[model samples]
Target chain A: MRHSTFFWFFLPTGLAMLLFIAFPIVSVISQSVFTPHEAVFVESENCGPFGCTTETTIDQDATAALREAKPLGQFVGLQIYLDRGHLATSEVAAAWRSTDSMGAFFKTINNLPFYRAMGFTLTYTFTVTPLLIILGFAIAVAVNSLHRHLKGLVIFFSLLPMIVTPLIGSLILFWMVDSRGVLGNFLQWMADDPDLSLKASTGLTWIMLIVYGVWHSAPFAFVVFYAGLQTLPQDTLESSRIDGATRWQQIRYVVIPHIMPLVTFVALIQIMDNFRVLEPIIGFNAEAHARSLSWIILNDLNGETQLLSSAATTSVLTILGVSILLSPVLVRTWRDFNSKA
Target chain B: MASQLNKKPLALSLFSTGFIVIWLILAAFPFIWTLWGSFKVELDFFSKADWTNALTGARTTVEYGSPFTGAGYHGAWVQEEFWRSVINTAIVCFFTVTISLTLGTLGGYALSRSGFKYVFWLLIAALIFRAMPPITLVSGYLLQFFNWNVWGILPTTIIVLVAINQPFTLWMLHSFFQKIPKELDESAIVDGCTRFQAFRYVIIPVMWPGVITTGLFSFLLAYNDFAVTTLLLAEENRTMVPAIAAFMGTTQTEGNVMFAVAAVVSATAPLFVLVMFFQRQIVSGLTAGAVKG
Candidate 1:
């Protein structure tokens, strides 16, 4: 409890977080403002019988040496952030000027990589959070009413979707909805369209990803709400029932109010989780039809070039988005702490 | 809370039961279907000729002379050298969990016991860190690790995972430690034990349940991770998730998609067993933060 003891006890974890979490954030910010060095070129004059020509060749060795000297690349301030790959300020401005209507403007903006990803990420985050909450609450209520013996079985099965790796879960669903797979085949049969493919259309892909998101996260909500349900005030419930309240009325007046805090808790956590939304895109191979900020960063970081600067810029923008989403929660927590103290 | 008066109407009961059944099927059917499909050849698993071939393994019978086959598993585990990745994953998970819990317990204990405003700020900082996508941090790690020549290795990935695991681990364990009556440790100190001695003797023994729960989560984070491991590790040092991802990339065109399927099933088996045994701890761990809120 003393200062020195607390210091020693906290040092290891604090140091880990500082070095990895805090330091990397700083590194990402710096990297975002920097671009990789350009290849050095050497020009040579070739003498011929009647003509002379200048031939320029890349000096790979010098470029490699420069890269070696400064692995963080050349600092370009906020150039990368405004470039076509990321914020694309100029492109947005041009699109705004060119498009006559808001819908057309949005359509043009959607063609830009960053704004397109932002649109999907925000939509997925907002839609999935509330939907999963409703679905989770429904499951919690339904499972709560089941026989005690069935609770464990239902819960064990329920946790499977959430507990499995996100990539694998999405992959399983992806295969099932493949054109030749069971669900896809069944859909074709039901709709009487043998050529229908979920992956071919943007709307369907977005829906698929959203459904996957809800399915994957709903169990987490269910568990938390289920726990909140355990400590429900029987006295209040009985009193409400004695007042000739129906089941729905008892729930509306007694149950939902009691679990309101838990609902907020789940919402906050799910918003954070859903905002990332990376693996499912990869697993579903939905990148062609849909993309998220995390997925774009992943795509940028990958492949032959590594695109470090581009990825870092996207990373910074994504972090800003997360902070914007998190600010309200932080303010609420601070207020609660102040009131309690 | 289930009492005589709490009985639902027949229609309501039926509807709720039906809803639960639909949800359970939605939740469990994918894993079950995948597990069954992983044993068949690509054609039968994704049959266009007849959907029933997936269930009956008609093509599998025609080719391998059996309704089921382990060809995909063998192809993935042996031909593609997926076992190495599995071993790498095991090593990463082991170290990440052990080191994360070790650091987390100490820090969480300190934070819980110390009556200071700074403790609140530290947790808030951690909450922010926890919200930042791991992919963002990957770019940072890639730049620094490349500079340090520490990229593309299991140890580096393990340390990064342990660090990422710390925030949630600290938050969970801090809440857990708060629940342990402060008197337990204060009493130990009164008996002439040093703070370290009190922690080592009194707090450590009673901390296992919470620690175990936190460790389970740490293990899950390290195990299920794809972005960090894929980016931070070299081809030879890949973990199972990344390895399976690699399989998807290279094997999709070679009539080897089933190999990726098998690898996915293999990678998920451990988590399946983990949830089976630690369902309660996992649930409690998840709610620990919310309960405090």
Candidate 2:
């Protein structure tokens, strides 16, 4: 009777999940694999900036010959044009005729800047998540030690960045970093040199971007850690202190282990969020140095004739990559649930 | 007693105060700068050395010597664009918070008490949605909506903001609901209450903190959002962050002063009120989902 009641209760949520979330992802992955390359219609009527229009008709003989050579339904190739209604070369057309294999298609995408962007994203996520976790834990511990009245003030103030828009944060950073701004000027004075400029390309751009991200995200980490701290059984902690455990020892043995689940949670989220870091990139124009996976997806999607397939492929890759990396967390979560059940 | 002696209260208090002061200063630098920058005039804003210049500093006879030389508080406050941005933000926040809370609370309750065999799947879905970068979804939503042919479509700006905020709120609220015991629902039902009635009278009251925290965070999400608003919103409907971006993007030098002022006002005002009202709940809610049994 209990089993029947439980089954009836869960039916709606299960259906909703299958329909809304799982369906979109499955469809996206299927589209990535089975999607045929159709000729993109470069609409002549409203083409912006780039005014190139050309149609190359493949003759019956050419189609037959190309199909015989590649044994594919269609040829995948770039059609370059100098102007509206003009084809650049028949050679360009021939190249398209020969390239029909999935291997070539995948190779083309992998060779593009997308892979580099993915690398940057991975690095960003790995770097930021750990740093944010450590910083957050430290801040949370510090805040937890404060008196009741001052604790509120400390937490509220630390969380200020989480409230400000990332774009605004970038703007503030931009002003400060600009050669003429106060920060730049201060650095110049501190160096005792009038000629030193802070705006020039250096590793500093990446540093600044990371700093901005840390400032914005640490509040979230701090708040979560603070909450975790609150939930630690007071008796356990008091017992640890009674055993003559030092503060560091208590934190290491008692608090860290207790909060490991929360730390893992924060780490998982930070990985995803930092991997998709786009606003600060756009706002700061740090894209040249720091192109994250999301930036690559955006750039690909924004092509004159949208490369939805490529974008979809990249999105699938990201989802898969992140899932693989987070498998340990997922396994732990699953095991915990199974044990509980 | 001997062990307790080592945990000196005064030393701990001093240590905590020192640490907090440093953290607060680091965290509050951008906000304080925004506040200060908002008050300064254009020339004083851009003049590299003029950061130290007081509001009453020598008004040079040269035109554009100082932003304060010409504009007063009234003049600054009367800008049409500034006020419009505030209204636009409020509208966005109101809709975002309302929709998120309504759907999130219902969905969260369903997840908590429904004994749904697929509750794990729902939880995973919510996490995926929450985990996917806002930018990735924003790009897809933009392309899909830009070419949308449906008549009477809501503005892309509003839709994008709502979509970006929904996943986060849903995840947070779902966790909140899950934290509430199922026995509450069973007891309420045993007392002749319907599901909706129990939810309304019992669950919601107990879960108000979760709701408030989620709602307030949604408001902050909407208010702080820029990439979507900038990319999706048309010129007339742009929110405060995008407007600040525009002001920064433009050629005008004086606009930065205005941008800084607006930035401070827009980001701080709502957040201040939220933190004041729901500090405990907000802190607890943020951490609760992070570490679960």
Candidate 3:
């Protein structure tokens, strides 16, 4: 544990993070300010015999050379961030001034790409985090009451949703909700309207995405909470039971407090996760209805032009969003560490 | 607190039983239904005439003279070259899990034993790093990977994923290492062993269980990732998840969504097997944080 040994031991991972994780963050922040080179134009003249004419010609070779030499592009600070695709400060102001009512304002603001995406992202994050925690807790409690042999079988199936690839998981659900699929038929039958479709409504799309999020993640919470349940104090439960506490009362008073730390752990992780909700949006083909900050960045990154600057801007905004979302957990962890010390 | 008590609370038991049944159906039915649907002919699975045809394989029986056909799986795995992506995923997962575990084990041990103030802050920094949307970092990597000519290949993507997977692995391994008494290695050091030798001889032998648990998670991350692998990899170099996504994209135009259905079930089978085998390790790995946090 000496300084030299510690340095040597940590060097590889520290270097990896610095080069890949930490360094890219710095690079992304700077890249947001820079852009790819634009084509240069120059007047070209041609003379034949006696007459000469000039035309504005794009200097493609020069532009390619320039881009190759300094590929980071020109530095334009805060411009991209404030543009319509991102912060959209001017657009927001216009929407705010044009619309008098809160509903109207949101209607207009929702037309702006960033705000709309942000709205879905925030709603998805906040709604899914607590919902999954409650669902996971319920599953844990229910499974804990099951017979021992059934426990492994239930847990095995439970782990499937959590372990499967996010896109695959969502796609499986996505297909099921197709009008021709089983769930889709069942849904239409239940509603007594054959034309009823999940894909038509933005509200339904968002609900499906959130449901997928919960289905995919609740197992994580269940497994963690289930494990926590194993270490519960028998004495405390016995004492509570002897006091004529109902099962619900016992869970509310005794069981919950014991697993409160796990709850915090699951909540913190889920919020961080839900904030980066990108894959489900793509998998559900819900991008038209529910774009996330991560999806916006991917949108920019994947196209033919590889909108690096725009993607970088969105990346910066997303990092800021993640930091803001995670700030509470950071502060609590720090405070707890200091107190323990 | 399983159903161990002698006194039968019939109402609670009934409610729990109902909840379990509902949850099990919710959790397990989608895959089972999809699996069944994948085997039947396309129309029989997505029946227009009667919804019961899906159950009856009506068109499937008419076309193939049987209720099932491997045509979708055949189209995907052979015609679409889905196996290339499967192999690519295997390579990426194997290398990523191994590399990240190697780096994470050393780094985690250092953090746990060093007792330096910075160790705490390093982990804190890693926590922040771990939480950041990795796609945000992909923009940074895009220009660099292009400039360095490291883009669109398996090894570069593997190393990048290992780096992204590092923080969580390190945190998990660090917590797992903390549970072992420091004296395990310190005693070996006392018996004429250097620190490195003690770690190699004493600590590592005992670290396999934790590493294997951590390794399963790393494998999962590598296997399950879409953001990093999708962006960094080339068309031919795509992993299974992105390949499946691609299948969804083109299959609609091809009028062959069944290919995607077959691919989905194909992709899910390995994960199901993994869960059945490594359920205990997965659970332990998950709770390693809960117990400490």
Candidate 4:
């Protein structure tokens, strides 16, 4: 295709992405450095019955005018990034000096919003990715062994957990695991503890979210690996069987090696996804116990207080996290493209 | 492939079958259990007295004189006017899918046909954009949209979704376009046709299978979206997912959690139907990238 034709063809999508995706990223970074204007205050004198006092009252008109004049607000550079809500540089230093043990130091750091969210997001991403891969691969192999007709049925049911909206999926589980709900009741019976609520403990909340994450994503892995299984080389499998290789041995040697690329593909995509981990927090109402980076951004953007600057800062930090996770995938894609070319 | 040599030992076969059954239940039981529980009253649905009440709807029978009740659904769809949100969702999904596919097909085809290094960079840029959590983008949009006085409206959300949908759509369709023999379009170009005309006359005719698959995914993204819709929309303009989320906040405090349950089930019903019809396309679309890699 000629450059002119290509330009016309790509213009719409390119423009959409440039405006919405690229522009927003620039906007977020700029917003991170700038904050909403502070309320302009003026001192007023009140004199009544031989008593006089001066009061500092917010001048609404001036404040509104200032905000209206410069919507991006005053530029604070990296001030917001280092504040108590985010990086908390001074707070971390204080904790580092005061704590006598590593556990205490971590406990202090975990109280900071940014570190807390990062802790959960990274833990969730790392734990869920490997676990879901194993579960998905196991399901794929098991389904592959089933009768051909049963495969479709199994797949249809398997896709439900993933296909449903994340919030809705988590809400369903949350309701089931509420203290009085079926699963919660069963748990109390099994453990002989009537007061064992999953929501009350930080460790349990993390476990619940991770479990939900694995349930939500394993099907994606299963589908891809299942597709990989379809084109497996029968001759190699037959030879392995003739050599008296057990089922586990064949999978370890032939099947796993065949699907290794798919596994990598699933892992990279899941890592990018699991890093966000927003909806389940909202659904479970587990914000008090666990928060992800995306959730922090959402919380800042939500409700009576817009907190745009704070949210924008978290967003910039989250974008940094995403890029760090995405670098490996980008490098691999580059290598693949170069080889193909 | 299922011959004597491939036959599993009895214990192994039983274990695998058992595992499959356990996995299936894990995958599908929550929806089943939610659907069943949604018809009961809050007391029965979350019964402290007896867990079996949820299954049997014991308290539901005493209150409504029936084992099952539609009160939760009625409260959600009728009293709460969830139908408005449903209509909003329909409009959003319709426009998002149509516009996304139109722009995506053109861009994807161009990228596939071009030999320039810039095409590679564009795709890499798109992958980076795709990886960024959309909430980050929403924070960027909040300030701008509020400034432009365009927030909390259907068109604004639709355009944003279409934009967010572009990266994945372009990647998927680009790969799909690559599989279409280049000669198909080139032959048309040789016959006194402009590039656009070749695409319009020849390429469009044979692109439906790929387009449909891409369209299914685009629909799914728009439909299942919670992040963009919840943040971008006003209360009155909410979609089903956000509406159900809203229900949780209000109803949980009111002791009307059953309403949220019914709303969740109602929201999930269409997805169930969609999967029933489009399972094949969804699977193929999902594996398309992995296959290429």
What TM-scores result for chain A when each predicted structure is judged separately against the true chain A? Answer: 0.96, 0.70, 0.95, 0.95
DockQ of 4: 0.86
Give the per-residue lDDT of model 4 (tens digit) for B62-107.
Answer: 9999989999999999989999999999999999999999999999
Runs in model 2 lying further than 4 Å from the true structure: A1-112, A193-195, A232-244, A299-310, B2-4, B8-17, B54-80, B142-147, B150-166, B179-181, B187-193, B200-206, B251-257, B260-264
The fnat score for candidate 4 comes to 0.91
DockQ of each model vs. true complex? 0.81, 0.39, 0.77, 0.86
What value does the lDDT take at residue A218 in candidate 2? 90
Q: Write the per-residue lDDT of candidate 1 for residues B1-293, one digit (tens) a residue.
A: 44778877899999999999999999999899999999999999999889999999999999999999999999999999999998998999999999999999999999999998999999999999999899999888886787689989888998999999999999999999999999999999999999999999999999999999999999989999988988999999999888888888899989899999999999989999999999999999888888778
Clashing pairs in 4: none
Task: List, residue by residue over B1-293, the lDDT tens digit for candidate 3.
Answer: 43354255898789888998898898999899889999887787777568888887889889889888998999899999899999999999999999999999999999999887899899999999999988999999988888789899999999999999999999999998998899999999889998789889999999999999999999999999999999999999999999998888899788898899999999999998899899899999888888888
Q: Give the better candidate number (2 or 3) by TM-score.
A: 3
Query: Chain B vs. true chain B: TM-score for each candidate?
Result: 0.98, 0.80, 0.97, 0.98
**Candidate structures ordered by DockQ, highest first:** 4, 1, 3, 2
Candidate 1 docking class = high
Kindly report which residue stretches of model 3 are placed more than 4 angstroms away from their true locations once superposed: A45-53, A60-70, B1-8
Per-residue C-alpha lDDT of model 4 across residues A1-341, encoded as one tens digit per residue: 88999999999999999999999999989989998788999999999998999999999999999988987789899999999999999999999999999999999999898999999999999999999999999999999989989999999999999999999999999999999989999998999999999999999999999999999999999999999999999999999998989888999999999999999999999999999999999999999999999998888888688888899899999999999888888888899899989
Q: Model 2 over residues B182-268: C-alpha lDDT tens digits?
A: 888779988998777777898877987778878877777778775566555666776677666665555246553554445545556
* Alpha carbon lDDT at A204, candidate 2: 68
Candidate 1 lDDT by residue in tens digits, A224-283: 999999999998999888888999999899999999999999999899999999999989
Worst 10 residues of 4 chain A by lDDT: A296-305
**Model 3 lDDT tens row, A1-341:** 89999999999999999999988999998899997677999898998888999888889899998987887788788999999999999988998888889999889888999989999999999999999999999999999978999999999888888999999999999888888888888899899989988888999999999999999999999999999999999889888887888877889999999999999999999999999999899888998789999999999999988898899899999889899888988899899889978
